[model samples]
Target: MTFVHWLAGQAGQTFASACVMTILVLMLFMAMKLYKSYRRNQTHLVLIIVLPLIIIQNGVLISLSDPEWSASPYLHIGYSFVSLLSFIIINFVFMKLYTGPASRLKGMPFFLMAIGLVVVTAAQIAYKPEMLSGPIAPGGVDLLALDFYGLILNFIILLNLRGVDQRINYQTSLIVYFVYQLSDMADSYVFHGEKPMLLIFIHLLPIVYYTLLFLLLFEWVLERLMMTFQSSITDGLTSLYNRRHFNKKAEQLLRDMKRIAIIFCDIDNFKKLNDTQGHHKADNVLKQVAEIIKEETAGIGTAGRYGGEELLGLIAAPGVKPEDVAEAIRSRVEKETMVTISVGVSISREGTSIAEIVSQADEAMYQSKTTGKNKVTLHPSVSQKRPRSESEGSKRSKQA
Candidate 1:
């Protein structure tokens, strides 16, 4: 019966390693995809090398644990040592990534990990741990001494990685890894080969550890993909939808809504500001004006950077007057920033497409720019009167 239980334990170990091999292979594919997407990313580059090595190491373990012959004790020891080194490699690379994107790490952590690996290996060689071959059985502390040393070294690595981004939630994976290591060290001792119910933990814990790490990696990849998508659609300077994407969204809204409005805004004397104040100051003022436009258009509509110092807002909501929103944007820009903006509001009538409506708004904005610098104008096709209720809110801003 004792011999049967030991054989079962050995088989379970092989099964656990097989499950981890599948997870490592999946991780490798994701890493390769990430590297292909971002050639400059350091984390993805290291993962491409590390994951394949880890996968090969796992395969070596599975090959050595051949069920029929049970392999040699020395063979298992050699496989275990290689697996331990893989752990060190994986942890070191990821710790740097999670800390920050900057190259501020300066390799101190790598030095620490390398030194720990050397010391641990030297001690294991000198101590010559008995039965480094199979499940550790209940005995003197010396039997599990090397494992405890490795665990302590892992804890030190965790300390170095303490400032990881909390949003990533890596702590959960760390907890699982700790349990897997502890179970591996206490495997035969705790189960004693009789308690089969609890005995499965020794095999299953390794799989759980790998699965958690894989989930964390998947989440990281998802975040990078989302960021890439956002950058493609938005203006890098203003953080507003760029002209192309804005046009796409506006057309979609025009198709669904019975009536929509476009407000075109052009900054007054923007080139003069750029000439006198320098590009940096001009940029600051432009950002301030953009902020005002964004705030006024929030909820009722969306704003976009049309081009240069021009901006556009599209209102799709019913019962919302476009002329009033334009006046509010003009008033706020004049009051809150170093300069003013000339705005024009145009509403869609039956035959108008997004292009036609925007063209009408642009003509009205040109009217305001030519007649006087800082005010709002409504397209000739729409009523020119301001809503009386909102006029008091914008009374301080001069009109053309």
Candidate 2:
């Protein structure tokens, strides 16, 4: 139960360091993958380079945990230098990523931090050159020098950046790392390894710290993947599902239920709207109509952008009428926006393919467009559906 034999001893410290090293190695591989995927992004390139340097620091700490080993004073200085500077620069990389990947990070903050790190490192050797004789562990006062500066630097960066950037996703990681650094600083100045429990905790902090950092990178990767997926499945302008994804949803719905419906909407005189009001204005109108369709179909079904000025809704709720949904879409477009729409709805039968259903809806929509604009029409094959007049749809919308 006690840590005296294992945790407080060299074995425990080495084990902890080994865990940190393992986490660092995994982070390195992730960094490599990111850099490989985005070769042009200098931020990833910086991560790929610095992670290996930090990993080597952990490897050295593991090797030197044994009491029998001795290292030169220069080696001690190198250890602190590598650990401090690499992590500080990596924090700069964090800021760069938040700004955007393509942004060059040659700002005043980076320049000042670079100069400050060099100055602190120089002061460490100047104040007390790693003694030529009796190479030993950095004492309490020694930690107050460069290591303390590193801690303060990180704290300041996070404090200021928290105000400047609202999208720092790795906040938990930063907090854990702050506590880890604080604990290490506490061990050096307060207990000085006299308390085995605190020493064990200090040794374990690296594992917790590095593990949190690794997870942060993993989370960032997942977020990027999600954004890519959303971009692929959704229209960039209206943010509705694209034609391909809409069809996919239709197929999936047809499989799950015995009946489904497709409401196809086409904006009236959309080419005139685009030509008269310009692209930006026409895009707003299209987006507004898409929003009406999405709102009317919420929960019962999904809405999508089928093409230019063309949007769709797929209804799968049992007992819900497709014609009613189509009318609501048409009435809303007429009342709410600068333009009106002609809509046609087709319900899926036992043997209808998604293409066939969409074709039927399109056919019905063409009939409405030819007869009158701003109307709802049902497929002729649906015996019970009565095509709603523009006045009836408007009255029903007013009633609702």
Candidate 3:
């Protein structure tokens, strides 16, 4: 056999293999999605699973049908219709899942659909009946029309991706799939009947596309799990570490540090304020106090919401006094919010446990509350005759 004949046979076999592989992978993906949807009771996953099945059918029909039959205008039109309809359905499903019905489309999808319709109609009008007598040829007007149709379908899919949550996966998969379709369309024209080497490479595009999509999906699932773990440790009301996380992290900090400080802060008259100003205003005050604490303790330590109307700060920096950190936070809360915070400082020494440090700070904070509403106090063991900073004294006098 001539080289051309051998090359053609190899190309044909490769194309067949590629089609089979794509179908199998797609079916597996569909089954996976189906199981997930069933477990989660989410009906929306049905559309994505079904759409791929339709595309798989199209691929199978194209691979097995006679070239002349596939090239016929009626079959060509039917293929385009089925492919376009699948994209439309899948696009709607994605848009509904991500953006909701309110912003599903602002006319872009419909406009693209109209454009695709015009291209297909124009292709049918420009078709020559005489061309049917010859073997399948490249660059026909009908092929151009189909290419345009596929392009519009891809554009619609991309449009659905707008406003999707960035952390969620599948954005990359959608883009890869779009590029794969376009490359496949272009390859049909570029490698038709000759160039077996290039055709073999083109045939591998689906494998690459699906593999990348699988990897991206795995990454997305991992990200979601991480986010869930973070949320568990975080305080939803203030976006700070919760008491549970604070306990765990403070223990870790103490293990690595020779000197550490714990500052406990309680909002003064918070219950009265909540009763008078309402829960909404009380929430705002809590959020503002949390922000102040976060800013003051950043880098020097970790801060968290210990409980209602109370916040905790842990500072492990050498040469840093717990009183100074407490005063900084007390001053900021007084200046920034309508309410005042009483802060208590406790210094960690050799063989001191985290529980002991927290207890000392809490007692000191209670002393501030009992003596005066908005003052910073230190546990008697760590208290010294050191004069308070001028700024801290001034802020306290203003509160007085």
Candidate 4:
């Protein structure tokens, strides 16, 4: 064969291979996702398993058919079958991802399918079948009917692009599928039997389409896993690290540090505030205080909600005073939220247990509560017994 003829044959085989590979890869991902959802008891996502099956069936049928049969009546029947399956998949995805009137349009697919089948059948009977046996000629009824079905399917798929849940992976998959179909349709009319280079490139488009689908699926899966991890470690109300995550991280920090500071803070008269202002208002106060603590601890330590109306912070660094941080937090809470917090700070060196440090801080904080609200107190071991004015001057200097 001439090189040109050889290249054409290779291109055709490559197109078939691309379709087969795409089907295999899609099926693998769908199976993995299905298995994961099944293990999680998320049966709602199990229906997605059927989508890859539809694509696989379509690919297999297309690979088996000859290019010359592209517009033939039998080929039209194959296309109709694929279109119907696509409609089924689209309807399922729309209902699963969206709600309201659009989701209620479930029966529309069946209605359209029935009308399409009747119209295609009549068109095939009325027109000469021989005239439809090539790349979609202008007036060929078979190709027209197929094109009409494609347009309607694309319209339905496009509707799904709006107002659907942002987290749904199938959204990107459907978009890729729609673009693939549109490219196929464009190639049929615009590049049919064209230059060798253009034809080869056109045939290779499916490989790109399927590869994008795989990447989008991988991205979706990774995002979900990250979100799950974040939710587990974070406080839902204040977005601070929860107590469990805080302790786990603090233990790691303590092991690596020579000097560590632990600060325990509690809102004064918090129960009275909740009773007078309601739990909703109390929650707002907690959130505001958490934000202030987080801001104050930024770059110096990690802060978290230890329990109701209480927060804990860990600072591990040389030449940094824990008392300064406690005072900073106290002042910010008072200034920003018009509320008072009693803060207790403890500095630990070698041979100090996490529990011991926390206990010291808690004890000092209680001392502040007893003495007066909105004051910072250091553990007796760390306190220098400086005059009150000098200590206040030192705190102001450190804050500056």
Q: What residue pairs clash in candidate 3, if any at all?
A: none
- Name the regions of candidate 2 deviating beyond 4 angstroms: 68-71, 99-108, 137-143, 163-169, 384-386, 392-400
Sorted by TM-score, highest first, which candidate order results? 2, 1, 4, 3
lDDT (tens digit, per residue) of candidate 3 on 294-398: 888898898999999999988988877777778888877777788888888888889988889999989988888887668778888786653233354544544
Write one digit per residue (lDDT tens) for candidate 4, span 295-392.
88888889888889889888886778888888888877776784678888888857887778888889888887777557788888787663112235
The 10-residue segment of model 3 with minimum total lDDT is 386-395
Model 2 alpha-carbon miss at residue 379, Å:
1.5
Q: Give stretches of model 3 more than 4 Å off.
A: 1-44, 51-147, 159-161, 165-191, 384-400
| Candidate models: Cα lDDT each | 0.73, 0.78, 0.68, 0.66
Whichever of 1 and 3 has more lDDT, that candidate is: 1
Supply candidate 1's per-residue lDDT for 272: 88
Model 2 TM:
0.90
**Candidate 1 local lDDT, 1-400, one digit each (tens):** 5744653566766777889989999998988888887865787788788888788777776665464333344555555566666777777656655666553455665667667766776676567755554543333223254477568766766665546664345666666777767766665356444665455675677688778778778877787789899999888878888889988888888888868899999998899889988999989888888788888888987888999999998898899988878888887887778787888888999988888998998988888787665778888889756422224544455332
Ten residues in sequence with the least summed lDDT for candidate 1: 136-145
- The most accurate candidate by TM-score is 2
